[model samples]
Target: MNAQTFGPMSGEPVGPAFYLADEEHHADGGGTMLGFWIYLMSDCLIFAVLFAIYGVLGSNYAGGPSPRDLFELPLVAVNTAMLLLSSITCGFAMLAMEEGRVRRTQGWLAATALFGAAFLAIELHEFSTLIAHGATPQRSAFLSSFFTLVGTHGLHVTVGLVWMATLMAQVGRHGLIQANKRRLMCLSMFWHFLDVIWVGVFTFVYLLGMLR
Candidate 1:
């Protein structure tokens, strides 16, 4: 009877198994990033369409209130600051994550969530004030476009906050495991993307609208 050796001393199949596992892990990571990029692209397209619609119809106020008449630049500026600050705090969280500091990462994430919540609160207040003043979407083409664009962004921020809360719970339970780290990275991208889109909105929808 021939003796069978399954040990590494006889150059068994352990090395190939590990290599395949590593390959599969890498593939999974790459796939996740790719899928996330695709999702972001789709979101970008949605925003682009909204922007285009606004450009076409923003001036048709139907003899109603215009941008300068309605938009409170000072308040909007404060809201923008909140979002921008949240982005910075989110970056700090990512740094902590990279350093494997779970507590610090969660702290930064909590701070970011707070800032994001503040932003949403301000935006909601603005919306409510506008609606109370009879500047609703049904009033004019301009108001319709304005509400659609800004409201969509606000909805995204709300969703992001919920997502952040879920992630915080996961981090507390999992302590920055590879999956949690990947989720954080994805959220980082999403948060920064919203920041960029808001800048465009502030510039085109608010700043230029005020001038027009």
Candidate 2:
């Protein structure tokens, strides 16, 4: 944020970018959504760079296992389904919120959290299995790139689950007020964004990796 020196025009209130302490100013919620979109775009750039790195280094097995030798596509497919279904439940939660059904919204949020947790569980199991078979990140450049790309995504989902649970608790305590609605909208976007990213991961990393 640039410092605003006092001038002939310095009496005006600061923009949302420069000021966030005024909750009343942001009660309309436009600034919050725009800020969230900016954050998502930044997140997209990070993932894009990760994908490019994987494309370059994913083949450097360093005399270790290749994707076909390590990737369990069946298990990965199941994990993908869990995440994709969680997106659906997240959408349902948003709908329930719009309808002012607090209980239904919380229920769907809980479902989304469960599905997200299952996805993470499967991913961790896959990681442990690979490490058990000596396919750790240090084993090869391929494994290094693989873990970097996929693990970053898993970390995001873990954060989303935590956020979802906290938001659910807030909704339970406060109902579908304006504040909770704004949070619900933000979480909906985040959950769906992760689902889209996972589709790319499943196709580019898992499916195409198997083909390699």
Candidate 3:
């Protein structure tokens, strides 16, 4: 409502100092955060279902290769490291942004993008190697589930990389304005969520496969 309208409702005179923008902006921030969190929760449900499916179908190899024959711990470990490092760099970017150090924030964001790219490259290589070894998704039920779970995660990473690049450009152009800072926070949450998911995959899928 306009100031005059509000003033009449309050039975007081309107002041020149009143601003609706401040209230709107504050509400906008809270709304954006809430919307994104709801989105993340939905994504959590998607992954939960995927994990459940994989758990049920994981051992149905149809006499084909199991995780032991397919998984390379050394390469998987390196891929995990790449993603974990990206998380660190992303955190550093947030800190820099908090301090209003635009150049440092941009540098750290760039570092994060590099690590994210490295993670994708390593994942792609692993997929290619598995396919080359005749462990295609259609080879067995186990292979199908593995590819679906891991490939879905890879797809998320690819999108994250794209978002990271876009956000970097935005920061470069806008210099960490409030909008850019908000976007950065959302990206950080997303990237860290992926990191958490990968940890689950590593332990449940990779490590447990070794034991089984």
Candidate 4:
């Protein structure tokens, strides 16, 4: 037998299967997940600092544009609905991916993106209206804390939209690969985290501001 026909010990050249890309792909996936988790932790730390700052500065009204005067409950209600719906749709996207349904995943992702976009639109409108009414962040300590807390969350949502777009592109290019699924999982966590933070903002900033 030729050397190509078999290994030195087993008399076989091993299975006819060995691809560098496949191996590298798995390694890349693992590294990507680890790096993403580290990034998430760092993000948590940043949010924690922002939250602490908000806690300290939240009550300073500076006699201008208090939350009670500036916050429109009806508009915020719509914004809340948009974000909550997006989270739900994002969850559906994950479910579709888990079932290996690529088209359904894409549909859910599209829906989630639309809802997220709506949330951003409404928030921008709210900010514009407030600024037009002379309730800009520069107007008061209350407005400053309010903007820092809510604007940070809005910025995160904007980033999430970008991330969602990238994920949709990957899904289009690669289908529902394991790596894509893992990334979707991380994004899901991030989306849900933002939802929770919004809850805190609604309760502490909006609702409580009205009481005071």
Candidate 5:
């Protein structure tokens, strides 16, 4: 159960044509997938605690802006679509890789990155908008809990974008090596995992807040 070092394939003379056989490639792929699942479990633990805190403090607006006062459904909808689109584009990238189309794969990866960037931009805008309206996290217990849950999700997206860009650079420099391919697949899981978490964020933080 040792974690594997992800890079060029073994005995493949790391300079050109970095091909790895299906066996070696699949082994590493399984390892990467397992590792990512573990990471996601840890993230879930962190989110669970945040959700509990938010649950306790969610109604304590303390004479400050409430969810109905602060949330713009249309803006949050747009942000949600951005993340969903990125997840789709990331799936396309994986498909392209499976079919051995390097150029097309890069194109899909680039599109995914663009969508992710858009999501992050909207998130930053939303945060700024809230702060401008005096809805800062420090303003109330509700706000503090709100920012912690949503901000943690935003931070994950930021890291995912960075990871995508680094993988894209590797794809360009080394072409579709098996390890790189496996790593890309792992990233696809991470990207989609974030998207799923965003769904929860939208449901609990946005929808439930608005309802309550």
Candidate 6:
């Protein structure tokens, strides 16, 4: 007697079975990059709106403080240098990651975190000084937009610093595995994006505002 093989659901012969390739099971990192890029684009929109709002309300100081009166170029320049330096250090970290030098990558990440923290500190000081002088957001339309724009940027830096720290811990434990590498790359993009945005802020919001 001949016995017939049947499929799971019906009495039909099954064709050859197929399975996913090993490469198909593993991520190629492109999805991560694409998703991060989308996030950056959305963030760009947020910053663009803030920039527009600032442009419109910047002159509406309501007889309160103005950018030239509040902005200290020297301090802002130092803060900008810190963020720019962090971006460089983050690049070095990515290079180290590529080389599979886990410790070196961690060291560079630490340096980047330090620079980022310094930038935040200077920004906080500036904000405190402004608030002390009654330049609170409620004081005028200009102050409202100014704080909204710059404070939002500062908040992003803070989040980046926190993410960097978490990634450092992950690398310390996992030794630059694929997942960790992807995270680092995303963070690299984020850190550099913030640096670019700061340049715009320094120029459009500070330099031009001072001129106005």
Candidate 3 lDDT over residue span 113-153, tens digit each: 99989999999999999999999999988889889998999
- Model 4 spans with C-alpha error above 4 angstroms: 1-31
Query: How do the residues 84-127 of candidate 4 rate in per-residue lDDT, one tens digit apiece?
Result: 99999999999999999999998999999999999999999988
Point to the candidate with the largest lDDT. Answer: 1
Task: Supply the global lDDT for candidate 5.
Answer: 0.88
Write down the RMSD of all candidates, one decimal each: 5.1, 4.8, 3.6, 5.8, 7.7, 5.4
Among all windows of 10 consecutive residues in model 6, the one with the lowest summed lDDT is 16-25
Q: Which pairs clash in model 5?
A: none
Question: 1-212, model 5: which lDDT tens digit per residue?
Answer: 43334546664333222334445655657756777789889988998899899999999999888899999999999999999999999999999999988889999999999999999999999999999988999999999999999999899989998998899889999999988888898889888889988998899999998897
Better of 2 and 3 by TM-score: 3
Cα lDDT listed for each candidate: 0.94, 0.92, 0.90, 0.84, 0.88, 0.92
- Candidate 3 structure, TM-score to reference: 0.90
Candidate 4 lDDT (Cα, whole model)? 0.84
TM-score, predicted candidate 2 vs. hidden true structure: 0.89
Over 99-162, each residue of candidate 6 has an lDDT whose tens digit, in order, gives 9999999999999999999999999999999999989999999999999999999999999999
Look at candidate 4 and give me any clashing residue pairs: 6-11, 6-12, 7-12
Give all TM-scores, in the order shown. Answer: 0.89, 0.89, 0.90, 0.83, 0.85, 0.89
- Record all residue pairs in model 2 with backbone atoms less than 3 Å apart, i.e. clashing: none
Name model 6 segments beyond 4 Å from true.
1-26
- Of 5 and 6, the candidate ahead on lDDT is 6
* lDDT ranking of the models: 1, 2, 6, 3, 5, 4
